[model samples]
Target: MSNLLKILLIEDDAIEVMKLNRAITSLELKHQIIEANNGEEALEILKKKEILPDIILLDLNMPKINGIEFLGILKEDDTLKYIPTIILTTSNNQKDLLSCYKIGVAGYVLKPLKYEEYVSKIESLLSYWSINELIKV
Candidate 1:
């Protein structure tokens, strides 16, 4: 794994975004975070091909193009499908989980309530991805 990574975070909640930023800062990992308030915005970023992300942290519910819908489009795209997409949402619905997996999501993680728990989960997730053999764009 490389020392630095580019991460695309598609989350609408401001507070959740802040929390995630804080967690990443605490870990002190060399990473660049590109944020999108919704899936549509993320798609635009992907289309630009300016900065290809090593991983994507996606939220399920949003104003436009929800996570599942976005995943469906992304997985069908030959170029973008290779990048691992992980669901980090508050929803624990069984149907949501099953649907995301069926669409080829790398992981479906429930967002923890506690700040510390959130940080721990983010840390662990990042650590795992950083160590894994990811395909280079």
Candidate 2:
């Protein structure tokens, strides 16, 4: 895997987007975050085949084409399925967790209420991925 990573962030909430941005910035990692408000927009981006993200940060709740639906479509595609997708959701529901894992998500992480805890999670996640080997397209 490359040292610099391109991350696709699929989230509907603006405040959550801001928090993620803040967390990434605070980490001081050499990474690029591409944002999409919903799953449909993210699919469009993926279809373009311009710049494929190494990892995806997905949210379960969205306006249209929620994360579970998106994951189904993504995992069906041979090329896209290789990208590691992690669920960064506020939902602590057991059903949601089971659904995500069953759909083959890389990780399911609950969103922490505190900024410090959130940052810590992001930092650890990024650090781990940075060292790991990723499939090259």
Candidate 3:
């Protein structure tokens, strides 16, 4: 991966976003994070960008559009399908997991309920992506 890799985070919860930002900032991972409230907003941001994100951390539940539906649309687009997407959601339902995988998500992470655990998980995810084979930077 390159030193300038960027992460797109699609999450609706304000507290969760804050926690993710704090955890990522604390790590100094040489990654820039872009935020979106929901999948629809995220799609809009993506449409305007010249370069796609190296990784996407997507939440399952949201207001405008859910993660699985978003993934369906994203994968169908030739420009977006190559970017690896990781599902990060509070829901651990087997059906959800299966659906995410079926739609070709690169990874699935169940949100840790506790703040400390959440930080840890997010940090670990960043680290994993940094060393992942699919990453370009």
Candidate 4:
């Protein structure tokens, strides 16, 4: 990979987390993944800012500050706003999509039911981000 990413994965589902890890390992990517159980936890990680992530993979339906709320918070912060945030979610609701886009979410992707499809989406998502010229803080 030309640009290995430090990805912040904010997801509440344990199974989803495992699946993402499995996909990365299967793809043999060298990127690092930092996981957060929910949006609240993700904020704590971001607050430290020890090293901001290259990209954020967020889930829409999470407990304690859902994706929309989290995006609103993140976009308001000058420093954090530049970090690309992509929604990896099961919700393809039009309202949800509009809200996220309005809040300036970088990307929105619906989770596929099949694992193979899921892997394909993840691969594409990572591939795009890995090559893009990202802002480094």
Q: Give per-residue CA lDDT, model 4, range 1-137, as digits (tens).
A: 46999999999999999999999999999899999999999999999989799999999999889999999999999899999999999998999999999999999999999999999999999999999999995
Q: Please identify model 4 stretches exceeding 4 Å from their true place.
A: none
| Ten-residue stretch with the least lDDT total in model 4 | 1-10
Q: Using Cα atoms with residue i matched to residue i, what is each candidate's TM-score against the true structure?
A: 0.96, 0.96, 0.90, 0.98
**62 Cα displacement, candidate 4 (Å):** 0.8
lDDT by residue (16-120, candidate 3, tens digit) is 888888887777666888999999999998897675688999999998799999999999987788889999888989999999999999999998878788878
- lDDT by candidate, in order shown: 0.92, 0.93, 0.86, 0.96
RMSD per model, one decimal: 1.1, 1.3, 2.0, 0.7
Q: Kindly list the per-residue Cα lDDT of model 1 for residues 3-117, writing each as its tens digit.
A: 5668999999999899999999887877889999999999999998778899999999998899999999999888899999999999999999999999999998899889889
- How much does candidate 4 score in TM-score? 0.98
Better of 2 and 4 by TM-score: 4
Flag regions of model 1 displaced more than 4 Å.
Answer: none
Q: What pairs collide in candidate 1?
A: none
Best by TM-score: 4
Local lDDT at 15 for model 2:
96
In model 2, the runs with Cα more than 4 Å from the true position are none
So what's the TM-score on candidate 2?
0.96
